[model samples]
Target: MPPIDTSIKEHLNALLDRGKGAGAAKAPAASPVSTALQRDGASVDFENVIAEMLGAIQDMETQLSSVLEINTLLETDLNQAKERIRELRQEREKLLSTIARLEEEMPSKRELQMVIDQLIEERSDAEITIRDLRRRDEQVGAVLKGLQDAQRALEDSRAQLQSELAAVEVRLEAALKDCGKLETRNRALEEKNAANAAAIKELEADLRMALDERFRLSIELDETRRALAAMQGR
Candidate 1:
């Protein structure tokens, strides 16, 4: 297609050139009304062409302004999109760093579960140990009670023995007092028997002296009787 300006100029030059050619070919006896009509037709054609050209130019200017506005809006949207993508990239990097740091600080799932299981087992063992210790404490308490009972029994028996020993000692003291009295009585009887034996020895000596005296007296008496009887017979 031709340029709007160029087409308008070409159309106008063609009408002018046709007018010149018509004037040269026509006789000078052309009517004034027909000439006036020709000039009016030429002017109308020029005005129509000019109006079409102006309308086309105005339409082009309006289309160019719309395109510029659309381009400006598109550029603004593109720039905003680019800035948003950059922010997203930075956020993604920060999230990746956070994930890496957390991974280093925390344990793996399997290892953490194993540690928890071990802790549970340890708690179970501690509970069992506490139960065993409580049982042992009860046994020790029973043994201590038994020992206390034995001690009380031994103390009672000792008290009983002490009472029996006191009674025996009292009986021995009484018997010892009786033995002392018997020894004193036996000594007095022995002294009395000694005095009686001395008296019996003196009596025996006096009886022997008397018997000899009697015998001497009897002999003398018999001699006298014999003398007297002899005298009488003489």
Candidate 2:
């Protein structure tokens, strides 16, 4: 932000003081500001006020820019998490397929009894392999469940971020609109002040003419009185 020009404030104050001084020196006349300069703070430093507002808006935008960058990173993370979930789901499907194939190839109870009698050791090995497959399937199921829960959490976080971003955008828009309105109001005040200045000049001129006329009338009255007193003495 640029430094505020204190000179403008000083100039405006000087003008107001001068106007007051001029009014006090002359006969009482209607004030132009009381009637014509209706806007608030006709003598206030509006430029400085506007500059401050702009600076605040710039700050807000900068902060929002940072927030946007953070949101982008979070979105990237969300995407990565989704991809991981997809891969896990694919693995789970493959595991299920393997389990289905193994079940289809397994022997019936009567065949198992016959195989047990012919190869008891091989049956024990088959049992152990089947138990391991079941345990692996359970592990895959647990992993998939955990991934689903994490996905839900990420989605919730993303939704919150989106809501906050939307609100910030709304506030930024409102601030900009307010800035435009202040500019319009400042322009209107400048025009009003200009018109008031012209009117004051004309009023001052009329006052000077009136003062001159009064002075002339007073001199003539004194001369008439002197002439009458001289005639009365004769």
Candidate 3:
């Protein structure tokens, strides 16, 4: 019975060794984890590893979602900036056009101002001339009035001289009548004293000549005075 028991134990040991050699001879499996589980009777910690991998995948998906959201925000901001730039460009163009128009109009505006200033100066000159003309008219009117007064004075003097001449002519006529009456008396004495009668006739003729000369001189003087007055008026 002891030999039989020993033989059975040796056979079991040999079979176990043969199994290990066969496993070693075969190309090693790709994974040692599979051999370790079979030899060690260790259960695969699949639950904990799978949970850690799932957690990592979940964290990666969360990070991707955050990246996508950030890219979307940046795109929105870029589009907004583009629109703002476009508006700014448009405003700049409008301002430049306004400046160009103002520049073009500036010279014409200056010319218009110059023309207005010239017109103002011309109007001022015309006003000054008008004022001067009015003053000259006033002076001319004053001179005309003075001339009219002098003419009136000359007329008065001529009238007075004419009246005096008429009175003198009447006195000469009366003296001539008295001398004619004396001539008859002298004729009667002519036979008695011819020399004395001739002397009386001579004296009467001289007095008549003197009166005629006085009248002629008075007429010449009046004419000369009127000519002088007209020259002064001119």
Candidate 4:
């Protein structure tokens, strides 16, 4: 198998950290994540995070590829082993056929009996060879089974890992959506505040004008009372 890339794990962990405030524990899956992570002008590095996850998946696929290679080699060895066993069994069949034919045709021939004895000895040797072949075939079968088991385990791991990555992606998307909504709300609030400030400035100007008019009226009244006092003195 290709060496494990710990960087992929590290990247995944980083993305998980970014999603932590997405309130995985608090927020439902379909709901938007926490808007707290969103800065005014800053955005989440979603593309980068997803790219790293894809890289991790690629690494897992590479490991599975190695498992497949092992399975292929084992399958080849198994086929060869079975073929050798078949050849041995065929040799034994041919030997038995020869012996049967000889016995039927020449049972009364003296020299033919000697020939039958030699053929029987050869048949025993053939039987031993076939037995050895069968034993080797069993060993190959066991090895193939072990390789198949390993392949299954790798497949399961890949599937689980992919599922987890999918979850992370969902959370990230939720967080992004939350960020967008927050930024919009914040903008609206800022606009409202600016409008309120302008209204306050107009109110303050009106108040100042009212106060100036009152002061002018008091001054005019004082002047009129002085004129009435001067006319009475005359």
Candidates' lDDT values, in order?
0.51, 0.51, 0.50, 0.52
Output the number of the TM-score-best candidate.
Answer: 4
Evaluated at residue 31, the lDDT of candidate 4 is: 12
- Which regions of candidate 3 fall more than 4 Å away from where they truly are? 1-50, 107-113, 128-234
Q: lDDT by residue for model 4 over 131-169, one digit each (tens)?
A: 765665565556556655655665565566556556555
Cα error, candidate 2, residue 130 (Å): 1.6
> Model 4 off-target regions past 4 Å?
1-128, 221-234
Kindly list the per-residue Cα lDDT of model 3 for residues 1-234, writing each as its tens digit: 011134433543454465467556966433444455457764333333333433443454454455455556555655655555555455555555654554554434356557556645555555557876566556555655665565566556556655655655565565455555545444543333444334434533443454455457557646755776687689
Cα deviation of 106, candidate 4, in Å: 63
Candidate 1 regions exceeding 4 Å error are 1-44, 120-234
Give candidate 3's error at residue 232 in angstroms.
Answer: 99
Instruction: Please give the clash total of every predicted structure, in order.
Output: 0, 0, 0, 0
Better candidate by TM-score, 2 or 3 = 2
C-alpha lDDT (0 to 100) for residue 46 of candidate 1: 33
Every model's TM-score:
0.35, 0.37, 0.31, 0.39
